[model samples]
Target: MLKDRNITLTVPAMPEYVDLVRLTLYGIASKMKFTFEDIEDMKVAVSEACNNAVLHAYDKDDGTIEVRFAFVKDELSITVRDYGSSFTIEENKETPAMHGKSIDEIQSGGLGLYLMQALMDRVEVEHGGGTAVTLTKKRQRTEEPA
Candidate 1:
């Protein structure tokens, strides 16, 4: 069994709520002692994920986006999920990773996934009845002088 700090948030699938998600992550990143640059990167990645869910997830205004943040030793894992349409990977998969294709080649729409994979250490997209994007980033470890 694994024990870690976790936070979960759910909001209506609307563009207006994207910023709220960003701000929440910003606070969590800061609390976890992430550098300013890393926090900014997380904000961008999370906002993009949230925006995508809000824009493309549902046809009707009756869906919710669930975001969860898990903090483990030296790593933070973020998961964004939408109970709407599922996501499909583009065909031009040059690299093993979905984000391996160039921005132009991955013409599904938007630079969101690209940015998330670029900024985070690991990115994974899972589809079941809904779509979930998981982003993970490892924090820098400082050596204490003896």
Candidate 2:
């Protein structure tokens, strides 16, 4: 069975804090034995989520972004929350009427949310007093030699 561990961090809602989140995620994912590619994907997804919160969550520069990291065995889950705009995960996943269009053609800013959903095994968004995005990804299990 996988063990569950969690860490929480609150930082200023600024672009500079994105690197702090990336580093913290790298450490947790490394301990969970995530592959290099998986680590890369997680970093990108987490960064996107954080960026969204920083850009949309606060009108003044006084708010903070709360990041929570949870490790469940080979799976790592991240939650990014901000007290700003409200958004739905389902709404963000819709594609324009046109199919096979390049990302540039889509023109909607929710592409980051779409990419996060694609990269993570699970993605959920909650909006109340704040907006929170939960992302989960599992590490590939390795076989033991008999």
Candidate 3:
């Protein structure tokens, strides 16, 4: 049953459009029985990803970000795709040295990336053909004594 539980959303890369992502995620996470804490974490992480796309993904307000979600037995996977420029975690880590800024200072500029990592169980980012950020989280399942 979980195999077919895939959800997707495509919204303009505008700050106002991100609310849809958050609301949809809340509904899905609630339906999946995630804890309140977990749902909140996911919402924050998802928003950060979307915000990044909106802030960096386009030279103008003419792009859209696509978010897709999939469910498995005990895992939720969400992928956010954008068709504009984006920087990776390593790029953020390296930016400090290139401009003689402290790593801490530069890293702070990438706070969204850090928050997403801290909240999600797994995060993978791809840069080609637009940026794709995939986040995964595991749900605790009560097991039957075998």
Candidate 4:
């Protein structure tokens, strides 16, 4: 049996550091036998979370973003946390005007939450003094030839 494991990393709140998160995720997920498609989904989900922290966390001051990866049984849970300004998903919900508008007509931002939810098996957001987004993905088992 594989023992449960946790890996944590802290990076400066910057756009460039998001790629480091993705690289770490890929390395760990690949070792756990996650499918390529699933890994890609996770990468996108994690990237979105990191991007949110880098862009919205810390209004006028520098801060750090903490990423925690926990492996339990067949599930992988990733938490991206930032100790800075906080916001709610409701505040970023899509507007009615954006419904019928074309892609170019619509805005370029505010899709991170949707992307995270769509790509991950579960997404939980907590905020008070800061924001924490936890994304979970379950590993799919493959049947072996008998």
TM-score, per-candidate, Cα-based = 0.82, 0.86, 0.84, 0.92
Task: Please report the candidate that would top TM-score against the real structure.
Answer: 4
Indicate which candidate wins on lDDT. 4
Q: Write the per-residue lDDT of candidate 4 for residues 1-146, one digit (tens) a residue.
A: 33498999999999889999999999999988999999999999999899888888987548999999999888999999999999977788644467778888987668888888899999999987799999999999999999
TM-score of model 1 relative to the true fold?
0.82
Cα deviation of 85, candidate 2, in Å: 2.4
Better structure of 3 and 4 per TM-score: 4
Task: Give the least accurate 10-residue stretch of model 3, judged by summed lDDT.
Answer: 94-103
Q: Could you give candidate 2's per-residue lDDT for residues 1-146 as a string of tens digits?
A: 33776899999999999999999999888877889999999999999999999888888889899999988767788999998867776775565664788777766566888799889999988899889999999899989899
- Residue by residue across 25-111, what tens digits does model 1's lDDT show? 888877788889888888888888888888888998899999999998778888999989876777324334545678766555456
Candidate 2, clashing residue pairs? none
User: Global CA lDDT of candidate 4, please?
Assistant: 0.90
The whole-model lDDT of each prediction reads 0.84, 0.88, 0.86, 0.90
Write the candidate numbers in order of decreasing lDDT. 4, 2, 3, 1
Question: TM-score-based ranking, best first?
Answer: 4, 2, 3, 1
Which residue ranges in model 4 land beyond 4 Å of their true spot?
94-97, 102-104
| Cα RMSDs, all models | 5.0, 2.8, 3.8, 1.7
